[model samples]
Target: MSATATADLISRAQSGDHDAFRALTAPHVRELQVHCYRMLGSLQDAEDALQDSLLTAWRGLDRFEGRASLRTWLYKITTNRCLNARRSAARRRAHEWDIPGVHPPDPTRLGEVVWLEPLPDALVAGGVDALPGPEAHYERVESISLAFVTALQLLPRRQLAVLILRDVLGFPAKETADMLDSSVESVTSALKRARASLDRQRLSNPDREPPPAPRSRSEQELLATFVRAYEAADLEAVVALLTDDVFISMPPMPYEYEGLDTVAEFCARIFRAGRRFELVPTRANGQPAFGTYLRTPDGTSNGVGLFVLTLAGDRISAMTRFEKGVLPWFALPRSLPARGGLPGSRP
Candidate 1:
C-alpha cells in the first residue's frame, strides 16, 4: 500500500501484467464506483461509467507518467466519462422522467421534492473490501448517505464535482480546481454554494448515530412482518408497522402517497386487485429491500416491482417501489410461481 509499491504495480500493469494491474486497482474500486454513483445517481449508470473509465485507464496505462498519483489519474478519467455521459442522448431521454408526480401533491405536506432515489449504504460504506486506513475511510459512510447524495444531486454538475472533490474527498483546492478546469477561487465558491444547498436540505430529524448499519436484527423482524402482512393483504397489520408520516413513492412514475392512512389505502387498493406479491429479500442503500413479484388475478407470478424499505427507529418510514426492470439489478427473476394457498401456507 506504500507509494513506491503502488508505483511498481502500476508499471507492471502498464506492461500488461493483469494480476499486477488488479493489485494496483483493486483497493480503489469501491471508492471509484462511489465517485461514479455521485456523478450519476442511477446505480446502473454508475456501473456503466465505471466500466468505461476502467477500459480507458487500461488503454492509456502506458501513457501514465505518474505526475499525479495513479488514484488521481483514474479519478480524472472517471469524472470526465461521467460528464460526457451526462450529456448523452440516453441521459436526455432519462431526464424527461426526472420531474416526479404528474399531479402534484398538496404542497402543504410533502413539498415539491420529487426525483428521489434510494442508495444502499453497503455501496457507499466501502463495501466488503474497503481499505483499513483511517484517514482514507473517515466519514466515508456519512458522505454517501441518502440525504447527502440527494442534496448533491440537486447541485449543478460542476459544483457537485467541486464539492465532492474538495469537501468529501479532501482533494486540494488546486487539484480540485484543475479537475473541474476552473480557478481555485471558482472551486471555493462552488463548494460554498454546494454546502449551503445541502444545509437547506438537511433532514429535520437526523439520526443521533450514523444510520444504523442496514438490515439489523430489528429490521429483519420488521421486514418479515411486512412481508406477511402485505402478502396476506392484511391492511391493519401492515398499517401497524408504518410510521404516522410514512411516505410511498414510485419512481419513473411520479406519485408520492404520504401518511399512514394514504399509504394504507394504496396498499388496500393493490390488495383488492387480487394480485399477490412474492417478496425476495435483498439489501440496497444499507436498508432492507425486496424484489417484489406480483401474482396476477389469474394466479401467475410476474415481476412488477422492486420495493426498498426505509426504517426510522422501529416503524417503516418510507417504501420506494421501482419498476420491474430493476429486478435484474437485484438478481431477481422476471417471474415466479404462483402461490398454491394463502401466504404463510405450509408446503
Candidate 2:
C-alpha cells in the first residue's frame, strides 16, 4: 500500500475504526503467526501469542509513531509477546508415558523440547514471503523445519528473538535491535552466538546426502514404501528404509531413540503388541507426515498420533511423533469407522 494510504488507515484506526484496523493488519497476520511459532515452537502457543499481540497492537495503535512500517511495528509486538509467553508459568511441561499395552525400549536419551508441535504445510503454504532480506542465512523452508525449530527452543530467549528477527526473517540488525530495544551491536552479538549454537544442534554426519526435493517422485516413492511397511507392521521393510543413524523422538513423553537398533527396538515393541495402524497422510513443516490410527477389535480405527519424517536422500533420517491431540490442528479426524479404504491416500 502507498504510504499515504497506510497513513490514512492508521488515522482512521486511531479514531476507533475497527475495519480500518483489520485492513491495516490483515496482510501481515499470517507471517506474524509463523514468527510466533518459530519463537514458541508450538502452533497453539503461537496462535495465542498472535491473538494477544493483535489485541495489544489495537490498544496501542495511538502509540505507533510512523517510525517503522506497520508490518515491522506488528512484528515488534508479536516478537515481544512470544518472548513473554516463553516465560509464562503455564508453559507446557514434559509428559510421562501413557500408552497402554506396550512398553517402549529404553530411550537413547531424554528429549529436552517436549512441547514441540508441527506447523501444517497448509498454514504456511503461501504465508511466508518468498523474498527474504539479503542477510538471511537460512532458506525459509530450512528455518521452519522441525530440526530448526527444535534447535531454536534451546537458545536463550533473547538470543532466539534476535536470531529469528535478524537471520530467519532477515531484518537488518538495526531494525532487529530497535524491535528488541537493544543496541545494534548487542543484536549482532546475540545473532552470532545463536547461529553458532544452532549449527551445533543441527550437526549430522558430513557424508550424508541432502534430502530429496520436496514432494518429488523420489520423495513420494520413499513415503509410499514407508506407509505400506508401517501399516503392515513389517519391521524389516521399515528398517531397510532407515539410515543407520536415523533418530526417533516422541515429544511430551521425553523418550528419544537414535541409531538403527534402538529405533528398531522401539518399533518392534509397538508392533509386537499385536497393535496395527492405518496411516492417514498429511504434511507438516514442509515435510511428509501421517496421522496414525490404531485398529480396534471392533474394526474402528482410533487416532493414535502424528509422525513427521525427516529424510536424507532416499532414507528416512528422523521421525518425530506427537500425541493424537494434535490431529485437529491438521484438520484430521480423531477416529475412523471401519472402511475398505483409507481416509487420505499416502503422500
lDDT of 2 by residue, 1-347 (tens): 88899999999999999999999998888888889999999898899999999999999999999889888899999999899998873767899887799987888999899889999998777557646778887888888899989999999999999999888888999999999999999998998899889778755568888899998999999999999999889999999999999999888889999999999998999889998888999999988999999988777899999999999999999999999999999999999888655532332
Cα distance off (Å), candidate 1, residue 52: 2.5
lDDT of 2: 0.90
Q: Provide TM-scores for the models.
A: 0.80, 0.96
Scored against the true structure, residue 344 in model 1 reaches a CA lDDT of: 40
lDDT of 2 at 110: 94
Each candidate's number of clashing pairs is: 7, 0
Give the lDDT of residue 179 in candidate 1.
69
| Model 2 regions more than 4 Å off | 203-205, 341-347
Top candidate, metric TM-score = 2
After superposition on all CA atoms, what RMSD does each candidate show versus the true structure?
4.5, 2.3
What's the lDDT for all of these models? Answer: 0.71, 0.90
